[model samples]
Target chain A: MSCVTPSWSVAMKKNQLRVNEFGLIERFFRPLAVNNPGSASLQDDCATLSVKKGYQAIYSMDTMVEGIHFFKDDPADLIAKKLLRVNLSDLAASGGHPRGYLLALCLPHGFPLKWLENFSAGLQDDQTKFNVSLVGGDTTSSNGPITLSITAIGEIPKGRVIRRAGAMVGDDIFVSGCIGDAAIALKLFEEIGRAKTLKHYPSLYNRYILPEPRIGLGKLLAGTATACIDISDGLYADLNHICLASKVGAKIEMGAIPLSICATNIIEKNKDYWESVYGGGDDYELLFTANKDQRNVIENFASILNISISKVGCIQSGKGISILDQFGHVVPVRSFGWQHF
Target chain B: MSCVTPSWSVAMKKNQLRVNEFGLIERFFRPLAVNNPGSASLQDDCATLSVKKGYQAIYSMDTMVEGIHFFKDDPADLIAKKLLRVNLSDLAASGGHPRGYLLALCLPHGFPLKWLENFSAGLQDDQTKFNVSLVGGDTTSSNGPITLSITAIGEIPKGRVIRRAGAMVGDDIFVSGCIGDAAIALKLFEEIGRAKTLKHYPSLYNRYILPEPRIGLGKLLAGTATACIDISDGLYADLNHICLASKVGAKIEMGAIPLSICATNIIEKNKDYWESVYGGGDDYELLFTANKDQRNVIENFASILNISISKVGCIQSGKGISILDQFGHVVPVRSFGWQHF
Candidate 1:
């Protein structure tokens, strides 16, 4: 194959080439220099970082593809922020603080300049807010979906990083906030014409576009809770992740789930909305397990942290996740959870 | 669009899958337990890793795509090793010791099993060689290329991590090992059917498939070298990285460049082979700069490290890279170094 000459001048004319991934990276990240506490220089062929003595670094990676993770025209700015935020949420679930990130971007032909500008702006915004830097990344052209792969590096205070397998039988299960808003927002956005007939909930849309990562709550629960996971793959599936890792099962009470009034209203209006709550994805909330003895402590801590904490279920020595109805009997779920496979 | 019901088993197969944009990430990575260091009984909701005082952490990531980076049927085992080794080479370039890594894989439908087994065996080989572990990662199905994204975390003594911006004018430029063998090997590999006459150079082929990372040399140079970089995108482009980062220019003498006997033989047989050395990608060697006074020290150290070091160039005050022929006249390069863009 011949090496295609990318028209940087024409791309610049359209404002797409203002900051090729490398240019923006050089502008914002170059000044940080190397050797700051936890500093990974942007110039090295690679970054050098030290894991704390007696502590191992916690690492994770996620890739978001256009037309799969988000719509192709979903405001390039929002897409960039959401990409970083989702990875940050993963770090929060594991009780790891953002240290640095690596980005791999695959650009399709004729990538727009304004999109790159707005996308970089979004990246800069989140990086400033989160105090994370774009350390290094690769930029390549592809004939397929524009894919962004982010690997987030974080440090946990020695022995404080949470994992999925720490939950014990009988631990009280709690979720940090209302669930399913993102999925609801997705539906609403997909059917904007019908949104006028339904109640307008900008918060739901905001939840979908820019969900808050519960980094503080994660750090707060790091020392106290037994097991935790972020709700990226729907409640049931994410909760099952905790069970699988912790070697326990869970029984969640339907009535106890903290559904927002908007979610409740939506569900009442469309019976199928229950599927969104029970099986929808991309909520970015934290679900965790804690001992019953720590209930009062958790409540006080939650108040101090100013994040909602709701009891949704209890862990049991079993093999699968189950739900309870108002009658306190097992209710067969219509779906297990969202599966990427 | 419907949530496509992917055949999990078929998608997970190894050999049936061909390499494309997303490399062989999905077939190998399995979700594993998070072994947090701090909390005993590993019951904490989050892993709490205690950061040691006065020590900073280093992080880096790189993604290799099929066709864009490597070919599809390029020894599945070697492909796996190259993926990890290249990232480790990045860490080495920055003077960091490997700690662990997170992998994100995108696999096409109907991958094979034996391929995965061989790939994992290769990973096992490198894991033992480098003393690193697979920490965490994500796996998904894609309709595009097989892609592998690896984020490696490493540690350097506090304030000792190296950067490319520190090179001073007059600093001697040094590169480990003979350059261009990997590129020549690639060229020869591609012309295998027509160039049956050039089949004797197995060393060249090995260089292309498994370029050894100079980790120990990078570590040794960390304290002495003013700046460093890895030669992945050939010498010119990578040297430009150091120049741009350090705000300096460089002059390389063609005579000083170290060429392997296999590379020289190929060049003698085909004059065009010189282009491969100057413009080839995927040579995971380290290129660094140090003060002229340290030349003897570096020379002695190279012998001690058991690695060949060639003084190929010198840093100068200016803006770009230039090459000189034997008589000291400037020789125009035929191409800018290889670029993914």
Candidate 2:
């Protein structure tokens, strides 16, 4: 049977042209006000926020558009939840505690109220879970697809924030959680329709739809990790980031990669499994490198935190990233990574 | 002559898929290696920033998309500059000084490299002018209109950040600069063939393309203005935000509104003048309210700053907004303001 496609065009057919953005702001956005102690309210010229007395703030923004990032028929709540989470993932990678976020939403005309309600509910859930507040946002209507932009702010102890350029030549690289599950999940969802079988295993599909940002691990690794990044693109591509930023290189053992059982199963069932593992996107894992001696400590910390930590590679004194096969020979690998532009 | 209208469908082509946002971290977004004492290199997991050691950070985000917020033919440099300035306007409205920002760009495949070079140049200009450094960003290709999301981080002295809820019952409301130029400029551009007269006034057209964010005024009014907001939507709707947030109403003498010479000229020549002044959007002026005692100081400051300041109205005890006609009577308005949805 042909899979049912979501009709985004139908979902977006409304009299949005007749109404200007300001009117919508007065009607819908104003009523959902939250009193921010740092700033007076969203109605002000700009929000004035008070960060903690001594700590510095970390800020990041991410935007998603319908039919560009995800299917139009994708669940509205999931889309909203992912938008916030992706931004939070940035904060997490920065090793900061989520504090607050600003949202800018441009909705296509004819968006259902149900979608708004679900989206807001998902936002509320994530906000409460991450201990973040919604400070301010702009909601407007458009003649195009629905788009969401979220700017998240977080605070970290003075001098404790980590960055991407600190990797030493001998630092051991590590990634949290099994790799490639999200990409594999997307494949499964696309191939099998509905993802009903994976519903019983929420870990796989949830990772694809709603990633669990590694905020705690990121914070814990702030002063310890030599360099770090969130794995949104595939693992190899993400690690290449550390390599480029630190002016170093990396060598990963293909056999040591931590793959989810479900991911392995799906990959075994499909001939193009490599694509899911190497080129899949939307995995919000943190890939970092630490001093070689800190390996045992990182392992212990991961165990204590009940999160997976895999020793996938090590930093070297060269440029570019390389993956070693089981025979310990340098293998020619395609630059398998996701690109936006 | 017929206007050259780019087909919306052609303008919406997607770029090559990017699967490696992290991979380019080193290649594209590395911090300046020389490191100023203030530079927070991308070394730690997150940026460790010091906001005057004691001040809190203010944050805001804004996103713009092609075919929605801007046209395909819009100059890329102006687009980049406006995106950052708009976010700064938000900070200015809140009484904060810009420190840094994160950017996320989703570009279509056909986006010209020259466009990017010009866009980056514009960003570099603003970064220097505003003392904001680009800390990090994600770039991806999309199968849709180009989208940009900018998240700005700013600092404000503790207890000095202004908000919208502080307006007093009798505070005088003011706006910086004449309004309606941007709206008229857009109209002129849309009807350029028939409105050949507009080509002679490039400054008026520039208003629509490049809006000066009122950061200086925002910071100046931080300690003075009881309530403030950036006029993105229009006079009526944005001010209504201050009224709703401050739990007060306002009565504006329509005659006192500051209209640009260009706007006045266009209004006199056009049939729908009131619509342009009252409903035209994209005017990035600061609309603020202050205690009556501070009026002289504000006027002097405006003079010192070389920006026009107009007192348009006063806060009143009520729940909604009203416009006073020449005879000093409340007249029924057609609509409150523009609505995007």
Candidate 3:
């Protein structure tokens, strides 16, 4: 972990201290640990985590590197939040509530100091919203691209985690929130350029830059969802995940897929945009299967949570994910890119 | 972490598949998760960690960047092992036994696939030795140095963790194994150059390459030691951590500090090397403090565990670590570099 104890003591002097590695911790990292009692103010070697009795501690990690996962000039705060939310989404899909997280940051040489201030500010905002504390982390400077990894820790009651393996034949498939906004946003940025895309379609751009992790809804789906996953690799791609794990196939009606007004408008004008609506990724929305009889219970959940839920498909007794037309014609989309005619 | 579900299914055909992200996981990573039942063969969203009913889950994380933490040409196996051991040492120092770990790897473009085979081989060797499993991790290609981070999870009995804050005045300070081998090996590499140094002192070279985390001895010292820390930063620097955290100072008898035969010979020829003996780092040995009355019991532990135990100092009621001369004269080393000369 970088160097924990200094060569000789570099006493922290608030605000005026030089921005060395130690100063970064005192100014930007230490305050994040206040919510986690086991963090020991990021002083000791390891953090002590007390997992509640009968609950299993759970965690998922994701790493983001500048120029790869995100643009170098993207707002540092949004980048930080997206890194956190994406990992939180993994735990959320497993029906867990986050407790704390550990961060490992490799800062490239000559990176702007103001970016870090904004980055930590973003972590502060999300920690409050997600009810998580910064436990401990390692920070070091590198001569390469800026890299960040966060391991988000949470807990779920034993045996209650909604997994990707429990979907059964005839189970109704559902998705949370609007899908394809992020992937479409990225497509627009690629086609029309980022500046124009952001100016004309800011909502889609915002969806790409910031994803909302559905933790509350995921926890609510614990016993209800026969199988669950977060839609990170597009609807059809993630649907295949459930199909493969459960040894079942999925038939999704292309007409029933939900989309944001922005995505719907764009797709209507350019039929090619419909490709992104089905096959584009980075949707941090929950996708799951439940017994067909649970429709009323699931609908009530959508109304109560005030997020749209759409029944777009059903599990079938076979192998791959099929994108179906309104007339029940199946379009093969597995083992290859979408085989749409 | 990594985009787990593939875009389109690329069914694996043994060694013939292209080395894409999914192929890498199927070939190198899936086996690592077999021991952890909750890992679900590394196919699920998050790993479920079961903390023993009466124990608290503990974890520590470390990130090592190529060219910073290790030589670019260092064996891939040793680099992977060092990364895991350094993190395990933290949990070891806290009176815990590791259960599993999560790894995040950022591989530079063109990094050889062969290196990963050796790296995972190293992890397999250590996991067998330490009884830990790989829970989950993320791997991605990066334009930067290969940055690796491991978050090790373990458990310690409730209310029994030996924290750095528990050291008290009059406690006998103890250290495990030899102290300066790593720093001196690094110094030798810098002075005599790597080839000649490796030819001459392979023991010291190996010592620098692979640190033996004191997991067995650390677990043995659990209730016996009042406070503890693993020496990653040099002896004096790490000692200062206990002093700062416990609000106590230390008086170290230099004559009592243990040294290896290799270090002793080096110090005899060049007294300048003595600086690193006290001020150098990467000694993953446990440095601890126990009540003075427990001297006999501690001695018995050394004999039982078959590792040398040196009582080099005592906790004192003030602040800072004083390195004492043969005649018990204190040398000032508080606010600056060693004033020992």
Highest DockQ: which candidate? Answer: 3
DockQ result, candidate 3: 0.43
- C-alpha lDDT of residue B13 in model 1: 40
lDDT of 3 by residue, B179-288 (tens): 88887887898889888878999988887879999988778888989899998767887888788889999899989989999999999999878777777778788999
Best by TM-score: 3
Cα lDDT, model 2, residue B268:
80
In model 3, the clashing pairs are none
For candidate 2 chain A, the 10 contiguous residues with the lowest summed lDDT are A1-10
DockQ values of all predictions: 0.33, 0.34, 0.43
How would the docking of model 3 be graded?
Answer: acceptable
Give the TM-score comparing model 2 with the true structure, all chains together.
Answer: 0.87
Model 2 misplacement above 4 A: A1-36, A39-41, A189-203, A269-271, B1-48, B189-200
What does the lDDT read for residue B130 in candidate 1?
A: 82
The DockQ-based CAPRI class assigned to model 2 is: acceptable
State the lDDT of candidate 3 residue by residue for A1-341, as single tens digits: 22222312344334332465556787889999986789998878888877677788898988888776788888999999999999999999999989889999887544566888999999999999888889988887676788999998999888888889999999999999888888787778778888998899999978887899999889989999999999876787778878888999988999999988999999989977777767777888999999999999999988888999999989999787778888999765533322100
What is the Å distance of residue B42 in model 1 from its true position?
14
Alpha-carbon TM-score of each model against the true structure: 0.87, 0.87, 0.92
Full candidate order by lDDT, most accurate first = 3, 1, 2
